[model samples]
Target: MILDRQLLLSNAQPITATAVSTNTIDLAIARDIGIGDNLELFIKVIAAFAGGTSVQFAFITSANADLSSATVIVQTPAIPTASLVAGSEWLRVQVPALSQAAAMQRYIGVSYTVVGTFTGGTVTAGLALDREGTAYYPSGLNSGGF
Candidate 1:
């Protein structure tokens, strides 16, 4: 079951360059994300390739918006060299399980890298969380059940 889904990208801009790239937009997750819920990131790629062109997507998360400290949730393999044919591709990342005792606001998003040259290379991505059937609940004040 899927819940709490939102678009992570700020716009539909196609990145067409022969270099490693990063998106200026950063996705924000509120501290209220339900504990133990599974978080996932999805990327949709549309590209028209030429001259050995290729693209890849990576999902990264940081505890701070500045991303001074960041970790990769999904390590994507570089796309295969293109045959110069337009096509669509998909990539995704599933965040590791989270514990109620270790919850915090998270910053999550994706970055794409292009090799050689390409045109009409665009990417769209989003984030979703699936509620878990069971979760840990820390003990609370027990004064009422004497």
Candidate 2:
């Protein structure tokens, strides 16, 4: 899958505590998003989350850049710390069509809610146009001729 840097909400962002994404997609300028096609959000665990009982991921929209008055458009159930391993694809969801139904906020981003203290964790999140499911390929022939 191809991820656009401009559409990225977070790039290996740390999750030591509950916080909003480092970056946000500005829907006001990128007016083409969530119009005729569905926009997908991808969240990957770059580092194993530790010292946290659980964590919930939320897709939020806000009128302010700092997400002072944010609203959750969608969210995932509280995930146990054991499941938050490195290289895990925590979430991949289609962004709702807010523009079609009603007035929409200008900024959209990701937020992490931790139930306990998180000493370590890192995540990478972004917007993607498409994503292929997880698959493994056979290793290339080694030493021996095919």
Candidate 3:
């Protein structure tokens, strides 16, 4: 069976998850992704503290999940000497390329830490996949010829 170009699936969305002290944010794969596919992972860190505090953002994943994962794709200096203002404060992390194993059914995880003091905060993260090449082609195509 052949697939058409329009059958290709390319989509992206935002996934937000909360982060606690020394805890990892488990991210679920929205759909089955193929190898060589590009995925962007965004991480937002919102610090909630009574006084000034510091926080570090890190990216993590599971080996058992059969997905290649890396930490600190976009390495940013630790957030320090800042007060957690009311509202959503965050940092964004983007993973340009993604690697997948032979096995299917895999997911990614994100984790963070607060170096200073904060009552609580939220860590928002998500994945975006590139599906440009996933399209199918029809056989036997004829162009304007004599």
Top model number, lDDT? 2
lDDT of 1 by residue, 1-146 (tens): 35443445423446676322233223243455445655665555545545545666666566666544556656667776553234454565565554322432365556666776654655556555642245566788456766
Q: Write the per-residue lDDT of candidate 3 for residues 1-146, one digit (tens) a residue.
A: 22222212211111123242232223344434433644554443433443335655555554534324443334345666354333333344335434433321234444445564455544444454532224555777654593
Off by over 4 Å in 1: 1-7, 18-35, 46-52, 63-70, 81-87, 98-106, 130-146
> Which model is ahead, 2 or 3, in terms of lDDT?
2
Cα lDDT of model 3 overall?
Answer: 0.40
Candidates, ranked, TM-score: 2, 1, 3
Top candidate on TM-score is 2
lDDT at 144, model 2: 67
lDDT of each: 0.52, 0.84, 0.40
In candidate 3, the residue pairs with backbone N, CA or C atoms under 3 Å apart (3 or more residues apart, or in different chains) clash, namely: 4-136, 5-136, 45-91
The local lDDT score (0 to 100) that residue 7 gets in candidate 3 is 18
RMSD of each: 12.6, 3.7, 12.7
Task: Give candidate 2's error at residue 124 in angstroms.
Answer: 0.7
